[model samples]
Target: MRILGCSDICSIFTRKKKINTASESQLARCLSTLDLTALGIGSTLGVGVYVLAGSVSRDTAGPAVIISFAIAALASMIAGLCYAEFGARVPRAGSAYVYSYVTMGEFVAFLIGWTLILEYVIGSASVVRGLSTYVDALFNNSMRNAFKSAAHIDISHLSSYPDFFAFGVTILFSAALAFGAKESSLANNIFTVANLSVVIFVVIAGAFKADPANWNTHPPCTDEDCKQGKGGFAPYGIAGIISGAATCFYGFIGFDCVATTGEEARNPQKSIPIAIVASLSVVFLAYFGVSVVLTMVLPYYEQNPDAPFPHLFDKIGWEWAKWLVSLGAICGLCSSLLGAMYPLPRVIYAMASDGLIFKWMGKVNPRFHTPLMGTLSAGLLTGVLAAIFELNQLVNMMSIGTLLAYSIVAACVLILRYEESEVSEKKNDNTALTASSVLKLIINANKTTHATKLSARLVTSLVFLYFILCVCFTSLVARFTHDINNLEMWIIVPMIFLIISLVTVLFCIYLQPVSGTRLTFSVPLVPFLPALSILINVYLMMMLDIMTWVRFGVWMIVGLLIYFFYGVRHSDISVRKISMKSIRLDGRKNVDSPKFT
Candidate 1:
């Protein structure tokens, strides 16, 4: 009944739990590296590659969408590396949620788990809507109209009609997932292969037919006679490229889903890293190749969102190929939906088991050996939401949640790395200030020796400092100058770079370790890389519309309420510590300040 103090709150934040793999309660570890990689491909390479490519090209980046994809790829690479490091280190079920919980604390972990519901569950719903649209397109819109008429659920202000196919697929896949992981993986593998083959065929066929004239810039003009200069390759200029990158980022959501499967992966440390890297590489190449071909096959202005792939072929007089590509898209979307849905239940189970959600959801079905309640709950919710919401609304809401999660994972890596270094410094009794302890050796050596051979950390810090000074000098110059054509560039770009470089340099100088701790596969520049990843994620997140922030805020509030009310009371870790304290305090003199055993 005593009120929790600062120490108690800190204890909750700092608590670390080791997963017991030998326990009977653990999920099956049947997924191989190949299964994980395939899941990544299935999840990451879906509707984005097929649909987003042309839509972005027409509406935002024009021919410069290729650069947008590259920008997105870079952001994803930063996030992916952070994920690879944590996924290897933690090897748990909740992906970012587990990573945050283990490193940051229960509150941060609960928030992340809630955020992931937005990423995976809503992601699945968005994909379902896309799949339904594609199915309707393939079947001449009859099924959609029939369902809409039969139900006649009024939401004309929200969506055209209920997407019954979306709802139906969610149920079907939920049933499939209830069967077990192996069966779900098999289905994903088949659909993914079919999707990739179709993608390859499109890339190959489109290359031969691509016309050079299509690549030329055509500015927006009201006069039909004017054939060029609507805005050129970068119709919207540099701003368009950045905006396109923000939107295109949604395509790279899958690799992290691999992290969620860590509990089920065979040799997760090895498999998770390999799968994350391999899957991302494959998807990046696929996205790049498809974006290039899509732009070349048709003018950017002509690209359509509803059916970018098939419609392109249809315009080129290959009607049969359109239908074929449509079929492939349906398969791709379904596979993506499967990949997206697969992670939600595990996250729910992870959160529930931690007492952050309904405890009943944590229970595994005896027959299926899966989180049956979580699966059903997630599936039904997403399906219902998919039926009612517009596709753009669903898609627009996804990026902010995804970026927020990625930023947190990156932050966790940075925190964990620093914590590990601190712990190592405390534990290791080695007093050597020689060559063995690199930084200390530099400090303890003679001035002449120090002058001749500065430590690696010192050298790196100096280099970072130089860059920071240069950025500061440039910004000052830009601020004082009067002749510059683009005042915005001088005032904004240099100042931003200056801030980032200064932070990086300060971290390098202050956060250096007395002794380095190495891992088999750690991020190359520990804090720097993760910090950079966090910055990029935050910058991209800022580009999202106000509605996204509002929605994300609402989600966070709900998660906090659940954590304080249910999680605080029922937390397994907290309960264990409490019981231990009660026993240790038995008839203790300082009852109020009793020691924990």
Candidate 2:
């Protein structure tokens, strides 16, 4: 029991990686703000712009999908700010993984890195699967038909036939990444430029066919006939808009890819924040413009869900434009594929270098200045996933991992803001928590450094606890909304507890002094903005189905096993600490004894 309760075991998990040691990266630093912005845009502006706008407007938000995009964009921007601040401060390869390691601990960092690998792998596979499907549709489903005829084998949750095309595309791009950062980034830039041009063309061309009457059209139906109510600009109402915003939120996911390239950037502090904001701005404009044009060019109900752009051009007697749009769609998907795959190797490298995973994965190719082996490994794994699995099976898994990562990054920003420094984790002095002591601590928080640090740490922990409870409370309400009348006591008690906790957290945060540590760029509004980001992320996560949670749990278990069995023993920090301790003991023994002359 004592062995199980050993402090050494507990301390090992909470040990943080020092940022100063990771400041200089082995990877080549060649990316500019433009290149990074291109990465973000290319990675983010995929099939969503071409398909999501039309589907969401037609089925969910009506013309209000415009508002849906705006709402989702706002949430994404808030999360992006948190990423920007961390990217400027830490400027490491692993997006959330490195950030969490520096601020949280090794255990949390490993879990985040594990989740990130899941996100990128699934994200890449989904992109390529979409690409294969799009191409098959363009070719009249010949490829799918051929595969179906040759080797159709459908499992319950897998593809009906192997997606060889998707596999080939994934491997090809992975090889491209292995060539070098600059080369891969150049290709991404070209594809991104082409993708943007297509977006501009769509907006311009569709604007000519826009009709204001479409936005105001009211279908003749009673409340019983139309659950969403009579058709208009907001045919689906506020609930529908919020739901659509949840769906649209996926469109803004790839922006964090910008943060993953910190090590590759020439001036990460300046360029990373700039790239994150710029790419998000560009991606939002593209989505918003397309949604507006899509709703305006035709009635929301009339829009096609699968291939809206090509069909729109066809409906309007522009057959040539359909082919052009199809070509653009392929380019966009290719760019998205590259963007999704780009981060996986870098994240693996970061984790591997920290001795959390296989150290061989961290090796940078001297000639290419890239993680060649890891790149190939990731590409092969993603390719196999794309080749064997259906897109539906892979897509849902991506969201849970991404939302969790985003939520953690937001939480990290909040914690880091109140921290005195990166490595300041000393235990606070034991003090009684009486009313007068609390009042005095609050009052003198800014006057005394000790008070400031102590209060900041105490309140930060409280805020985190409150945040967990808030998520639980929100999930409970959502789960039992129908039974609220009968469960009023259950609901009311928790709600009251949550309110009190929120008020206390806010008050403490306000009274506590912020860290004096400066950064070139930092998240403003501190606890409020980050707190909102956490709430939004939690809400969105709650929106995911139960099966997603199950899958996430399974992945987490696998990660924990690896961390305990391998990472705990082989960690570089643990090894260094042991060596330092041994050195101190040896010196102490020598000093204690008399030396013979």
Candidate 3:
């Protein structure tokens, strides 16, 4: 950080200790591999799998729905490898938010943090909305009457509630986070395991009923009036597959969440990375296998793309099958959303400690030892978004923001590596005598310093590549794809909105003051990743129509209004900046090494 003097560096160090004040004793390092793996699966493989199968089959991949799932799986695998490494290395809260802070830049950190508002918070809302609809269906189907008068409510003021039970649950999760890390992890463990069983059961039993004929031809495409067997393979064609991938990509976003727990997880160096890859692998298998069975058991067009999977078992007369699926989804969402709740506050706390956000955001509950302010804000925003936005809109917006953040994080790793290479070599010149020995030393040092950098960049790249397919596929639907009912328009708008939001956020981050930021963990390579991230991002935007762009503009305006009116003066970062200057002469501020048993 050439921008800061030695005193500034000292200030940064002092602030770091304050962000995570919990002792390793306060937080449980007890998350087993199974526990971690379960969190990964629970979060990654939620309701998206149930709904996406029908959407892809009916609109995008057709029988090639298998291939679309396969493509997403591959993309996730590539990104997973990087995430694993970072999770292992950083093992800190704030996943990409922290990754950007350490390896990328502050603006990058802020952008990721801000955009994640779309991911976890918006995502939680989306899930709640989905769960609400499903619950409503179950109640109505079972009761055969209006249960509104049943005097039962999941959340009060049903129509006014954010999404579904999510806001309600988020309030609880935020409280969970504030009180302690151990309690949250334990809660995460229970829900994750329950959901894992659900996916495994869905996959195993589902496989038994597959009919091969479903793969041979399409019954019909409701998206268009088609002759029998005419709209076969690539159901929606390459274009539709791409579009569907964009939407379906929502399922894969879960794997990335594993990184968000980098700081909290025990042995994060080992667990975080493993959790990511394991989760992706597990979800891929389940999603692809389940999608195949879904098509086989029922005609792709026959399935309601909007509400397919839960109804899958009920249609077959499997008693409580729909309920089981719903239960699994609810549990899975609870655990993942809880995990999401943990990272953002730690990040805001970290930023505050660094003078990025409000000082209070960085302040720990002395009694609870958690970031009280950060977690609360995240929960509040999540509730509001869920209450207002519909499921499809929230999910679409989330996809764009996630893709944008992942893509940039990937590029930053590469950029940092390239810049530091020359300096590294110039310093290490002729360190050893023998040619082999010298070569070995240089190579070893480069590997030592650049390992994290390389892995991060590659992961970022693969993630970006996956989203590219999603963008292109979705855009094709806009151009050559035809739809009578306007479902395609939903995908188009999100893509466009994503581009606008990404660009605006990037500009905002870039325009920030250069004083307080530092590039401590830069890996290497820059322009290439950024350029590609930008290109693919822009292409995604153009692929959609004006309507999508307009909605995205609204989101940006809202974000700006919040930042200028509230976020600016109240930012923790700014507080940290002031705190940096007000240290004790001896330079110690009640340091504590928090640990979870």
lDDT of each: 0.76, 0.86, 0.60
- Write candidate 2's Cα lDDT for 1-597 as tens digits: 345456876687778988873557788999999999999999999989999999998889999999999999999999999999999998889999999998889988999999999999999999999899988987899999999999897687888898899989999999999989899999999988888998899999999999989999876567678744469999988878988999999999998999999889999999999999998999999999998998899888888998899879888999888877878888899999999999999999999888899889889999998999999999999999998887685577898889889888998888877776444434443566789777766555425443245666666676678578768866976687556647578677877787787767766665666677879999988778888888888888887788888988998899888888888878899778879999999999999988899
- Whichever of 1 and 3 has more lDDT, that candidate is 1
lDDT of 3 by residue, 192-229 (tens): 77877887788787777777776666563364766333
Summarize candidate 1's per-residue lDDT along 319-368 as a digit string, tens digits. Answer: 88976787688888988989999999999999888877889998888787
Candidate 2 Cα deviation (angstroms), residue 478: 2.8
List residue ranges in candidate 2 displaced over 4 A: 1-6, 21-23, 421-435, 439-451, 480-497, 584-597
- Measured by TM-score, the strongest candidate is 2
Alpha-carbon RMSD, candidate 1: 6.6
lDDT of 3 at 40: 76
Query: What's the ranking of the predictions by lDDT, best on top?
Result: 2, 1, 3
lDDT of 2: 0.86
